[model samples]
Target chain A: GAGVSQSPSNKVTEKGKDVELRCDPISGHTALYWYRQSLGQGLEFLIYFQGNSAPDKSGLPSDRFSAERTGGSVSTLTIQRTQQEDSAVYLCASSLEGGAPLHFGNGTRLTVT
Target chain B: DQQVKQNSPSLSVQEGRISILNCDYTNSMFDYFLWYKKYPAEGPTFLISISSIKDKNEDGRFTVFLNKSAKHLSLHIVPSQPGDSAVYFCAATPGGYNTDKLIFGTGTRLQVFP
Candidate 1:
C-alpha cells in the first residue's frame, strides 16, 4: 500500500456492543502501533507490535481493549462491551522500525451511542 | 498525570509571520521529541524532530528548539501560510533502545491567516 490503511473510517455503535477496527500497515513496515484520541485530547498509546516480538500492551486502558497483529502485517483492535466513554478516534501507525518516524492512517471514528 | 502539556489551546498568526507553539514535559528521561500537524478528518503528519543531544534542529521553514533544563520544546514555523492552519501535537519518547511509544501533548490549534 502507498500508505497505512484503516477500515471503517466511521462507526456508530450502541453501548455494550462490540466493535473492531482494522489496520493494514505500509508494506514491509516492521513496527506497528495503535492509539486513540478523544475529543480535544492527545494521542493515547494503546499497543505496539514489533516484528515477531511480544507486543507491548501496557498502554491498553482496560481489559475490554485488545489488539492482534497477524503475520506482522495486518492488525485488528477489538473493543468488547463498549461504553459511551469509548467514543473517539482510533488511530494506527507504522514505522520502518522502532524509533523511526511514524506514518499514520486517517483513523476510525467510533461513536458509542 | 500528563507527562506532556501544551498549555495554549490555540494560536493565531498572520501569513508571512512566524508561528511558535510551545510544549513542556515532566519526564526528563525523554530523549527524542517530534512535532506533528493534523487537519480535520486526516491523520497527523510528521513535521520535524530534535534529539535531546541537540538544542535546535531546522528543516526548511520549520525549526524545533529543545530546552532540556526546563523540559520544554517548541516548534517554529517561519513565514506562516494559511495552509499551515491545523492542530499541532508535540510528542516525546525515551529513546534508549527500541523505546518506540510516543507520549503526546494535548495539542495546539494554529490558525494562520492571510
Candidate 2:
C-alpha cells in the first residue's frame, strides 16, 4: 500500500461490547506500533510489533486490550468489554525499522456509548 | 507522571515570522527527540529530529535545538507559513537502540495567521 491504512475510521460501540480495529501497514515495513489518543491528549503507547511477533506488549492498558500482527503486514487490536474510558482514537504506525520515522494512518475513532 | 510536557497549549504567530515551540522532559535517559506536525482529521507527519549527541539539527525551514542539561528541546520554523498552522507534538525516546518506544507531549497548537 502507499501508506498505512486502518479500517472502520469511526466506530460506536456499546459498553461491554467487543470491538476489533484493523491496521494494514506499508509493504516492507518491519516495525508496527499502536497508540491511543484521547481528545486533546498526547499519544499513549499500546503495543509494538517487530515482524510477525510482538515483543513489547507492556504498554497494553489492561487485560481486555490485546493485539496481534500476522505476516508482518496486517494487525488487529481487540478490546473486550469496552468502557467509556476506552473511547479515543486508535492509531497505527509502521516504519522501515525500529527508531525510524513512522508512517501513520488516519486512525480509528472508537466511541464507547 | 507525564515525562514529557509542552506547557504552552497554544501559540499564535504571524506569517513570515518565526515560530518557536518548546518541550521539556523530566527523563534524562531520553536521548532521541522528534517533532511532529498534525492537521485536523489527519495523522501527524514527521517534521524534524535531533540526536542527544548534537545540540541542533536543521532541515530546510525547520530546526530542532536540544539542551541536554535543561532537558529541553525547541523547534523553530523560520518565516512561518500559514499552511504550517497545526498541532505540533514533541516526542522522545531513550535512544536509537532496541526498545525505543516514544513518549509524546500533550502538544501545542500552532496557529500561523497571514
Candidate 3:
C-alpha cells in the first residue's frame, strides 16, 4: 500500500463491550504504533512495536487495553470492557524504524456509549 | 504536566501573512522534532523536521526554529495560504536516529482566512 491504512473508520459500541481496531502499515515498515486521541485532546501514546521485540507496552493505560503486531506488519488494538472514557480516535502509524518520521492512517473513531 | 506543549490552541491569520506556531518541551533528551499537518477526518501528514544539531530548518514556505536553551520550537509559514488551514502537531522523540516513540503535543488549529 502507498501509506498506512486503518479499518472501520468509525465505530460505536455500548459500554462494557470489547472493540478491536485494525491497522495495515505500509509494506516493509518494521515499526508500528498505536495512539488514542480524545475529543479536542492531544494524542495519548498507547503502544509501540519494533520488529519482533517485546512491544513497549508501558504506555498502555490499563489492563483492559492491549495491542499486537503480527508478522511485523498488520496490527490490532483491542480494548476490553470499554467505557465511555474509551471513546476516542484510535490512530495507527508505521515507520521504517521506531522514532523516525511516521506515516499515519485515517484513525478509527470509536465511540463507547 | 505535558511533556510536549503547544500553548496556543488556535491561531488565525490572513492569507499572505505569516503564521507562527509555538511548541515547548521539557525534556532535553529530545534530539529530533517534527511538525505534522492534519485535515478533518484525515491522518496527520509530515510537514518538516529539525534535528537538535541545527537551529533552523526550512522547506520552501515552511521553516522550523529550535531554541535548545529555552526548550522551545516554532514553525513559521510565510505567506500563509488558505489551503494551509489545518491542525498542526509537534512531536519529539527522545532517543536518536531511527527510533519510534514520539511524544506529541495537543496541537494548534490554524485558520488561514483569504
Candidate 4:
C-alpha cells in the first residue's frame, strides 16, 4: 500500500475478451515484475517473480501470455485471446529482496478493441 | 532487432541546460545498467545506475556513463529541470544486483524547456 499496486487502471477489452492484470507488491518486496508498453514501444519484459516462482518467463510474448504469483505478494497477468496487437501498458514492478531500484505500478491500460 | 536502444526520440532541454540521454546495446551479455524516469501517468522512477564493472555512476546531479567497448550508455542530467521533463528509459541486465529480465529502451522524451 505504499508502492507497486496496479489493477484496472483502464481496460477496454473486446477483441476476444480475456484479460486479467493485477499486481500488488511492496510489502516485503521479494521481486515481481511484468512489463509492457506498446504504442510508442519499449519496456516489454513480460514476467518476473521470485517468490511465487517464475525463474523468467523469457519475456512471455506468446503462448497467449500467462503469469502468476502468490503468497509472495500477489501478481497476475493473463491475456488469453485479446488481440489488436494486444494493446499495452501493463507494467508492474517491485524489488528489494535482491534490490537494484525497482518500484513501479501505475499501469494497466490495456485496450484491445 | 532492438537490444535496447534509445535512438533519441526526443530531447529539448534548456532549463538549467545539461540533459543528454542516449543508450545503445547490442547485448554483449549486458551487465546491469539502468536509468528510468517517466511521467505522464507515472510509473518508472529510478534514475541512476551503471555497472559494466564501472565506467561511471553518480547520483545527486544524476550521472551514469558506461561505454563498455561501445555498447554505450549515457544519462546525464546536471542542471536540467522543469521537473526534469519526462520519459527517459534505458535498462539492461545481464543479471546484476536483482536482475529480473530487463532490456528496455525506446524512450527518451526529455523536454525541459523554460
Candidate 5:
C-alpha cells in the first residue's frame, strides 16, 4: 500500500455493542501502533506491535480494549461493551522500525451513542 | 497528569510572518521530540524532529528548538502561508532504541492568514 490504511472511516455504535477497527500497514513495515484521540485532546497511546515480538499493551485504557496484529502486517483493534466515553477517533500508524517517523491513517471515528 | 502540554489551543499569524508553536514536557527522560501537521479529515504527517542531544533541527521552512533545561520545545515556520493552517501536534518519546509509544500534547491550531 502507498500508506497505512484503516477501515470503517466512521462508525456509530450503541453503548454495550462491540466494534472493530482494522489497519493495514505499509508493505514491509516492521512496526504498527494504535492510538486514540478524543475530542479536543491529544493522541493517547493504546498498543504497539513490532515485528514478531510480543505487543506492548501497557497503554490500553481498560480490559475492554484489545488489539491483535497478524503476520506482522494487518492489525485489528476490538472494543467490547463500548461506553459513551469511548467515542473518539481511533488512529493507526506504522514505521519502518521503532524510533522511526510514523506514517498515519486518516483514522476511524467511532461514535458510541 | 498531562506529561506533554501545549498551553495555547490556537494561534493566528499573518502571511510572510513567522509562526511559533510551543510545547512543554515534564518528563526529562524524553530523548526525541517530533512535530506533526494535520488537516481536517486527514491524518497527521511528520513535520520535523529534534534529538535531545541537539538544541535545534531545521528543514527547509520548518525549525524545531529544544531547551532541555526548561523541558520546552517549539516549532517555528518561516514566512507562514495560508496553506500552512492546520493543527500541529508535539510528541516525545523516552530514551531508548524502542521509541514506539509517543506522548503527545494537546494540539495547537495555527491559522496563517494571507
Candidate 6:
C-alpha cells in the first residue's frame, strides 16, 4: 500500500482475553512503530523496529504486551490477558528511514469490556 | 514523569487568523521535534518538524519555532482555515528520529471558525 495500513479498525473484547493488532507499513519503509493513546492521555510508545536491529521495547507498559515485525514489513502487537486498563487506540506508523517524517495508519481502536 | 506537555487543551481562532500551539519538554537530551495533526477516529498526520540545530523552520502556511534554552516549541499556522481544525501533537526524541520512540504531548485541539 502507498500508506501504512492497520487491520481491524475497531476491536471489542472482554477483559482477560488476548488480542492481536496488525500493521502493514508503506512499501520499503525501514522503520515501524507502535503507540497507544489512552483516554485523555498522550500517545504512549509501545515498541519500535528499524531494519534488522533489535526492537526497543522500553515504552511497553507491561510484560503482557509484546510485538514482532516479520521480514521488516508487517508487524503485530499482542496483548495477553488483557485488562480493562489496557484499552486504548493502537496506532502504527512508518518512516522512510531513521529520523525521517513518519507516515501513519488510521489506527485500531481497541476496547476492553 | 511526563516528559512532554501541551498546557492548553483547546483554542479557537477565526478564519484567516494566526493560530499558535505551544509545547514544552523536560528532556534536555532531545534534539528533534515534530508536529502532528489528527482528526477524530484517525491517525495523526505529520505536519512539520525542526531539528535543534535551527530555532525556526517555515513551510508555506506552517512554521515551527524552538527555544532550546527554555525547552519549549511553538507551531504557528497562518491564515487558519476551518479545515485546519484538529488535534495537534508535539513529539520529540533524543536523536530527533523515529528509531527508539517519540515522547508526545497530550495534544491541543484547535478550532478555526469561519
Encode model 4's per-residue lDDT on B24-92: one tens digit a residue. 999899899899999987789887888799999898988898989999989998999899899999999
Residue pairs that clash (backbone atoms under 3 angstroms), model 5:
none
DockQ, Cα level, model 4: 0.31
Error of 2 at A12 (Å): 1.0
- Candidate 3 per-residue lDDT over residues B33-95, each given as its tens digit: 999999999998999999999999999999999999999999999989999999999999877
Single out the weakest 10-residue window by summed lDDT for candidate 5 chain B: B94-103
Query: How high is the DockQ of candidate 5?
Result: 0.76
Off by over 4 Å in 1: B96-98
TM-score of each prediction: 0.98, 0.96, 0.98, 0.34, 0.97, 0.97
**Which is the better candidate, 2 or 6, if ranked by lDDT?**
6
Poorest 10 consecutive residues of model 6 chain A by lDDT?
A95-104
> Residue B102 error for model 2, in Å?
0.9
Task: Please give the fraction of native interface contacts (Cα pairs under 8 Å between A and B) kept by each candidate.
Answer: 0.77, 0.65, 0.77, 0.79, 0.83, 0.79
Error of 6 at B97 (Å): 4.4
Give per-residue CA lDDT, model 5, range A4-67, as digits (tens): 9999999999999999999999998899999999999999999999989899999999999999
State the lDDT of candidate 6 residue by residue for B19-107, as single tens digits: 99999999999999999999999999999999999999999999999999999999999989999999999999897654467889999
- Give the true-structure RMSD of model 5: 1.1
Error of 2 at B48 (Å): 0.6
Cα lDDT of model 2 by residue, B38-104, tens digit? 8887888888888899999999999999999999999999989999999999998886534447889
Q: A1-113, model 2: which lDDT tens digit per residue?
A: 38999999999999999999999998888889999999889999899888645459988999999998887779999999999999999999888877557778999999999
lDDT of 5 by residue, B2-84 (tens): 99999999999999999999999999899899999989988889999889999999999999999999999999999899999
Off by over 4 Å in 6: none
TM-score of chain A of 3: 0.96
- Clash pairs, model 3 backbone: A98-B99, A98-B100, A99-B99, A99-B100
- When 1 and 2 are scored with TM-score, the better candidate is 1
Q: Which is the better candidate, 1 or 5, if ranked by DockQ?
A: 5
Clash count per candidate: 0, 0, 4, 0, 0, 0
- Please tell me which model should have the higher DockQ, number 3 or number 5: 3
* Candidate 2 Cα lDDT to native: 0.90
Docking class of 4: acceptable
Top candidate by DockQ = 3
Tens digits of per-residue lDDT, candidate 1, A16-37, equal 9999999999998899999999
